[model samples]
Target: MIQKKAYRFLLFLILQSCTQAQTFNKAKLDSFFVALNKNDQSMGNIAISANGVLVYQNAIGFSQINKGAKTPATIDTKYRVGSITKMFTAVMIFQLIDEGKLSFETPLARYFPQLPNASKINIREMLDHRSGLHNFTSDSLYSTYMGSLSLKLK
Candidate 1:
């Protein structure tokens, strides 16, 4: 009888632990939003995931700082990720390279030999930002580009 009771108690404890985890995490998210709203600085978006589950997220601020256009921000917003996305992309590229499916020094000429100077470009140079290929977005005229490129591609 004691062993059966202990088993039930253990099950109860496990359920209780799970409930408490969810409750506490929710409270933490609330506090985070409170802080984000309390700040006077330009609002920013936050991406958070736990157990690979993205629970709550929000974005607060004008889309364009100069124009004060209150563009509604969402998780789907595609702003330049800066260098962070590069690390992930580079890791995948290198993994393929290591698998012998690709090489860092592979020239563009291997795939498209028609382009002049294609042999001068290599995968390694592209990953290291030595490709010298101009970032079209870097042009001053490209400023204020807010729409996502992903959607267009899709």
Candidate 2:
């Protein structure tokens, strides 16, 4: 009799846990993010998933603020990642190097032979910012180029 009662209690506890996990308080989550947005604490999208299924998704704040005009951020917003790309590139390059698929001494020409002096540029030089490559984004025509339909390099 005691064994049967214990088994029933265990089953009840398992069911209760599953119900609580599946029926998450979405309103509470939204309110928390809304408070953050109102307080200017965060300005980006967040997505949560469970068992390969998305559970919660939200976006907050402005994507762009130019001359006091704001563009409300959305889940589809594309933010310029900027220097963060350098970090990701470095990490991936290091991984490849560690796996023996690449080396710091690899010449850039192997991948970008069209670039000027690519044969002289090594992975180490590029990673160390000593490759002598021109900063295209710093040029006067950069904005115009960005506004153009084709962003491809000549």
Candidate 3:
């Protein structure tokens, strides 16, 4: 799932960067997203901005997917962002590096000494996903915990 989201984000970035002009065909983009939602390929809100101004916004499908009751998704509906957090973390890391407050070569122990092999792992390794750290989401217990939390939150 993370890999799929990463690929989608990378493709979006490539497309965004390749465009020389800021202009976009809003109708075509809207149709594309509508088709994706109709085919059950996508279920989320999307917002596009240019020069810090909102350009377009749309939402499709349901916020909750359970069989019992589902909440229709809206522009204001919130969803679990998941691995998108990694991208923000990477950006922050880069910003810190630029500010000379952090370095890629710094050991993970400096921030997270409790993690296994933190002394041997570096920030760069973590950023590149080569740190040998266990993915908590891959554990069955994590899903169980999240499920319980959601139930309680409701």
Candidate 4:
């Protein structure tokens, strides 16, 4: 088993090293974002990275609008994200379980013992939204605490 794991790791490293460096067209990206901002078509940040190197980053549109006042978005702007976080959490948890680092039957208490009835909540239940967890995000102050962010890399 150990030898097989090592062999796979070596193969992965070899393949990674064999890949060629990628180039991006920064002018095209800038033009596209400029068009989007000019036409009021989209608002958000975009970042492109290749081989662990940041190649391009740009932001467009307003971050907030209140009382007819607008705040322009920047590359570091924060946005509110609601239930979409559940999708990322689910995918990461599934990956851990698939890699044998976690199990569906693992109790939430293993990591969050302070949570209400955590011992009774399992990974599967949490992923399925059946854990009976409280939805604190519905509170009015949730947005005031921390805003959400979106990121994509290619």
* Highest-lDDT candidate: 3
Lowest lDDT block of 10, candidate 4? 145-154
Per-residue error for 53 in candidate 4, Å, reads: 6.2
Q: Between the candidate structures 1 and 3, which one is better when assessed by lDDT?
A: 3
Model 1 stretches astray by more than 4 angstroms: 1-27, 40-55, 67-78, 112-116, 135-154
Clashing pairs in 3: none
TM-score of each: 0.55, 0.77, 0.58, 0.63
Q: Write the per-residue lDDT of candidate 1 for residues 5-58, one digit (tens) a residue.
A: 564475356445545575435564545445545553335576555678775566
Misplaced by over 4 Å in model 3 are 1-42, 45-59, 67-70, 74-76
Give the per-residue lDDT digits (tens) of candidate 4, residues 65-117.
Answer: 88999888899887767589999998999899999999999999999999999
Taking every candidate in turn, the Cα RMSD to the unseen true structure, in Å, is 11.9, 11.9, 6.7, 11.9
Residues 1-154, model 3: lDDT tens digits: 7755764685476447534455766776677667666756677888877779787788988889677787878897766777899999999999999999999999999989998899999989989999999988899799899888766655
Q: Is candidate 1 or candidate 2 better by lDDT?
A: 2
Compared with the true structure, the alpha-carbon lDDT of candidate 2 equals 0.79
lDDT of 1 at 72: 54
Residue pair clashes in candidate 4: 79-148
Question: Model 1: how far is 35 from its true place, Å?
Answer: 1.1
Candidate with the larger TM-score of 2 and 3: 2
